[model samples]
Target chain A: MLQCSRLSFTYEDASQPSLKEVSCRMGQGRLTVVTGPSGCGKTTLSRVINGLIPELYEGKLEGECLIGGEPTTARPIYRLSEQVGSVFQNPKTQFFTTDVRSELAFPLENTGVQPEAIQERIDQVADLFGITQLLDRDIFSLSGGEKQMIAIASSCMMDPQILVLDEPSGNLDVEAVASLARILGRLKDRGLTMVLIEHRLYYLDGLADDFLVMKDGRLTEHLTPTAMRGLDGPSRQARGLRALNLDANEDASAPASVATEKTPDLLRVRNLTYAYHHDQAPALNVDDLTLSSEDVTGIIGRNGAGKSTFASVLTGLLKPGDRSEISLNGTKQTARERVEDSYMVFQDVNYQLFSETVEGEMLLGARRTDLFREVAQKLDLERLLGRHPNTLSGGEKQRVAIAAAILSGKRLVVLDEPTSGLDLLHMNQVTGMIRYMRSLGVMVIVISHDQEFLAQTCQRFITFRQGRPVRDSRKLGNLLQAL
Target chain B: MRPISIYTRFLLVIFANALIFLTLPTPLVLAINIYFCSFQVIVGRVRKGQAWLLVCLVFALGASLAMVFPENLPGHYLLFLFVGVGRVLPLVLVAAFMMGTTKVSELVYLMRKIHAPQWLVIPVSVLFRFFPTVRHDYAQIRRAMKFRGIAVTTGDMVRHPMRTMEYIYVPLLNNATNVASDLTSAALTRGIGDPGPKTSIQRIVFTRLDALMCALGLVLMGCGAYVAMFQA
Candidate 1:
């Protein structure tokens, strides 16, 4: 259904082509998995297939792309969209409507489908995706998993024959990932063609008919199901691919297990709760929590479960309630006080980054030149010191954030979903930073949903369910049970 | 009653904006604003909540304040505030209905039905998607700043204004650009364009409700004009 011949695209103002002489052909009803390290032109290749390269982006194209045996260059995006449905990486950016029903009806209404048949199609698609209950729900109120499901279902709602998904699993939980895999299987059974551009592969291991590896802007290898299964961990590492089973990615967490035993609680919490609105129900209600100085604590929870909110309170960014008591080093602190004592590296990392350059960012609110240089070197960001923080890649930006936090002499560091959307290599870089922070006697707290990262890196685990903190007695087992 | 057409809703909102500069009576202004809010609730678009109650309270308070201090500058200012809010409420009503009840595709369909210029309507339609994305981005930026020990406050504004602006602008601008690019790609791939006969899942047609609402708005405008010229 889809074919790319010697497809090469050079973005305007860029010296080199983002996608080199690469080619891919996906048959109808077959799912192709494309894996590579970050900046390996996976997104570019998918965009090319979806006709966004030469269409939306003003890039010079070197080859022809065919959809259903017809050249895509001569067709407008709207025409191509009839056959090709594209779901982007970020779910929030793609949504134009506030509610689910409207979101699903978006494309159909755009194509001038009659209202009666529109409703009929909406029902059919919602039923097909098992999201009949979500039809009327508000889009923003949904969890990340649900939003992604909607993005995918809405993209394919008009019964498009070919669907291109870019990192659909980037923000999903393991259960969500499994459900996504199941949904893909259902679509495949429906005889719809699919191209999944993903870094998270364990979920796709069984479902994908072919695994194609694109490295350094080239299709280096293509592996079958049996070949992918027999591939070893080291070889996977060398190729910059994620582990088939996330629990086995112990490159960063396994060796760092030799750290010291648990120390006394450096932070204490009692009855920490938050309600987004006073008239609404409480979003979070944590009874008691403790943080030790000598252990790397990981906070794990499903999306929209208030784990990040709890981190905000722990790091002093969000002030605890008047009745709720929280103490850092046996002294109570307000939001501003927490701001001074602890530093949090946020999930986006773009929010905390305001400096023009890396050195400027690390030097903010401090004159610790020696400390800044030392932390920068330790985080392996010493070379990017002169580069603009905005221009750095995802992993580089994250380390820059961490290194800046350490330079400011904050003993307690909290990272919220730092390894999310990162490839295996970048994931290790972030995991490594957390370990390094712990080694320096900093009370490091990490909040994430990555099961492997939590199990392999954390000495203590705290889980949240529906905004209520659950004590994970058996580590990640409780997490799996929660799912 | 049947629902109103999105075209009528858009026209009503623009008319309401024009009515802002008119010198309508305070009570008449409040009545019209309340009517728009009530109309939205009647259509089952926006839920009647704190927002509705607050509007009612503001109208009541402004009326009483005007009564007690009709000649005083402060009282007149309060009345003007009421008028200002009254002028904006109808626009809010239209926005709420558009964002909640009408799908983006439906709006585009209505725009084309009226033969509105594509270059103009496309951005307006895309803006229905843009503002929400901007709001989401703004919240993320706030969370990220809070994480980095940077807090925006009156004290910071007073102490280091330029530095404070720098801290705020850099991330805001960067994220804004990123969000815009991502949104453009997503929108383009979804086939948001001037050409091609786009289909609609939500069939938008003129109903009696549209006629009634449009007539009511025009009648209100006429009454306000007469009251401003002769009665007030």
Candidate 2:
């Protein structure tokens, strides 16, 4: 079991504590979920449990954290690692190896485990995760979900008593989340105490044993799975929690065809194909498609399904094939023109935000500054104008990017996974921004694997498979099931 | 031929480093580059090895062309630039082959077997794993720069040097900072800092093929050294 008693921590340079007297006890063989809005101390608590608190990030720690009856305080991270295994949010950063086989063998190798015993453990863990085929594969070739599974498998190679997963499903799609739930369920059945820190709650409907809600660096509520499931919309919203239950067929009746037809200004494309290399097949091949400038369209696909490639091509960051055509309202536009007319907010907003201040970022490469004040006010970035882009929260940085896009006179804006790794409050904020962008007559294309964000924001859905749109529908709920 | 041992590759890399300074005969240089091209092909970098081979051929041709020109002829400096980079082309290719083919586990095991300190082994392994991620992040940063209408051209750099440098370095540094901490956390949590003898599942002993490759490298180095000392 994992236990925390009056835990509070402040970073070395931080003025305020990230975790404020947090207390919780998670039972063995049960999966306890820790969830809250951004900066709510859930991650800080996980760090405390994993012994990365005072060990790695030097902080003023005032707490008692125990994992499997062992106090985490005063112990080295490696010693605590023997009791608690940690899987971080970002799959790309956690891995220290280049191949699956080596990654699986890493933790064992570090602790002076014998080569033969390590190999045996690798085989057993791989079998447990149903990842035997992935044993010999390169880590880069695997999908986001597969990489995450390997991370879990590698962490479990030591057969630690407790497992801590921080937002493992942050980058996964609906199908991947389902697969993750199954894997976690298997781990729970094997009597491994699990702590999952996540904002996505629907997939954990029956899997989670308890839900611990934290706000303002304090544990606000602890509820059983039954009570968490029974939370109404208003109650969930007040707690800043995501929907506990996601029914794909609940509201499948709203067809977007009517709105799409009413909008006269449409961006049309013909035979649009883009290949990363000459000899290989096209990564994006949309033969014929029309997008309404008034409708917020959601592009849903698995990782490497060309959703991002399509966004790049559409935004003119990438050139299409020779026989392709893209026109706005019957007027053909070249790639250069498309570049001037569209802007894309990348998945990692850190890359897009180049300026030091929000104000400077808004006018970074703009041709006009007349809309700057209005866009800033609308996005609620007025008071944050002087603050550095690096200091702002993830959602604030995204809004700054959007504000910059709008101020630059862009009519088409693309947000690639804007709400990923974001809590319900932030996701709702993004949804509201998408609606606001649509109201301002900007065509929004959101490339996402987040079903809830898409359902709340987009009017039409385009599902891509094998580098092409296989299903274009208004019934997001129905299309989600198929995906 | 099967993949050669990483020890062979490491020996060849050191040999190539020495060869870079020595004024080897032209034919010997060409032969070495060709051997490395084939070595790369054996190691599954089919296209990269061939591309480097083609580049070396161009460099050799350009170097010969410059040799035929007068001492102070026009375009001689440009040709000389190619001559310099081209002279070490084979070494660069060898280094790439080593990085591309050698796994982190193999390298770590090799270091441990050699009785290297943990401080040296950890950083070297981390540096080896950091490059590919940096490359990926750099590609994204360039795309983001293009999307934001920041010109990523030489002309733009010359005109707005500070802004261009800011555009490139800010994101790169930010990602590096984040990845560094996250990577350390990951390494520490997995008992990478345990004060014990570290073991690895990777089998990293030299094979018969490695002996052959090392002998070849020694012979080549001897020939190059003889030429540099006597002929030059």
Interface CA RMSD, all predictions: 2.5, 1.0
Query: What does candidate 1's lDDT look like per residue over A430-483, in tens digits?
Result: 777777777667788888777766766787777788988766543455356654
Across B121-204, the per-residue lDDT of candidate 1 in tens digits comes to 767776776666667767766665554556545575568777666777788888777777877776676667526565555556
> DockQ for each of the predicted structures, in order?
0.50, 0.77
Q: Candidate 2, residues A1-483: lDDT per residue as tens digits?
A: 778899999999999999999888999898999998888989988888888887888979986887666789867788789888999888888898899999999998899999999989988998999999999998987888898899899889889999998999987767777889999999999999999999988889989998999998999999999999888877888999988787632452223523333354689999999999999999999999999876789998877789988888888888899999999999999888888788888878888888888899989888559877777888899999999998887789888988877777677889988888888888877877777667667888998877767777787889899999999987576435657
TM-score of chain B of each: 0.74, 0.88
Q: When superposed on Cα atoms, how far off is each prediction in RMSD?
A: 4.0, 2.7
Q: Which ten residues in a row have the lowest lDDT in candidate 2 chain B?
A: B66-75
Write candidate 2's Cα lDDT for B1-232 as tens digits. 3677878877877877877787766677777777777777776777887897897787767766765666674677756676677777878878888877788888888889899999999999988888888888888887777767787445766899887877889989888888888889889889998998888889866777678767877887787788789976
The per-residue C-alpha lDDT of model 1 at residue B205 equals 81
